[model samples]
Target: MSRIGKKPVALPSGVEAKIDGQTVEVKGPKGVRSFTATDDVTLAVEDGALSVTPRGKSKRARQQWGMTRTMVANLVTGVTDGFKKELEINGVGYRAAMEGKNIKLSLGLSHDVVFQVPDGVTVTAPKNTQLIVEGIDEQQVGQVAANIRAWRKPEPYKGKGIKYVDEYIFRKEGKKK
Candidate 1:
């Protein structure tokens, strides 16, 4: 019934997957990632591909079937290709710089905002206004970018703040004199 759940996840070359009870661990050149599935779904490897199936005819089982399959697919992709997020700072005085293992942001604030880099994720500032976040975990990379953007969201009037590379800010007209 679930189209996505019916498709098995293929293991590319140079990647290995191991199933331990309800947990699936995938190791690749980039890194190793693991995901545990709930009891509502069953995990198995058939003909070099990982598959997930519902345990019963219940609704929860069917839901887990698709969700677990996607989770396993993400693990494979994460270990093989990793994830990346880019941020752009737009403003007259707003800028970002790498300070050793931390990121120093000046978003027109009185003091520089120092963001400490956490383990398993790398933050780099290629230019004063450009930032790149890389990690094996997709969720972590996105969360880091969001936290950075939250510091100085792009304004509607001036569009001065940090935002994603492909994001667009809606402009607003100024008040009449």
Candidate 2:
């Protein structure tokens, strides 16, 4: 019944997948990643592809079937192409710069916000207003971008703040004079 689960994840050339019980490990040119599925689902590598199947007809099993399959697919993509997130500062004085392993952000605050870059992720600022977050782990890349954006969310009126490059801010009408 799960459309996503029914489709097998194809392993491209130069990418290798290993299965050990409920855990699946994938290694590619970019990096290596692994995922452990719950006992409600089964993981198997067959014919240069990975598949997930529920162990029973229970609701939990069906839910895990799809979720587990997606997780495995993410692991493969993470190890191969990796992930990236882009953010842009919109305020006049707001800007971002890389400081060694940390990022220095000026978001119209009293003091510059220093964000320490965590391991396994890289943050770069090609332009003062643009920030690029890249990492092999999709979750880490997204979380880092979110943490950076949380520092200065775009306002509805002026739209002055930090936001994703593709994000749109809903503007509101100003108070009547």
Per-model TM-score on C-alpha atoms? 0.97, 0.98
What candidate 1 gets wrong by more than 4 Å, as runs, is: none
Please list the residue runs of candidate 2 whose C-alpha ends up more than 4 Å from where it truly belongs after superposition.
Answer: none
Candidate 2, 1-177: lDDT as tens digits = 999999999999999999888889899999899988999998888999998999999999999999998998898888889899999899888898888999999988899999999999999899999999999999999999999999999999999998999999999999998
* Predictions in order: lDDT: 0.92, 0.92
Error of 1 at 42 (Å): 0.5
- List of clashing residue pairs for candidate 1: none
Report the C-alpha lDDT of model 1 over 10-62, residue by residue, as the tens digit.
99999999999999999999988999899998899888899998999999999
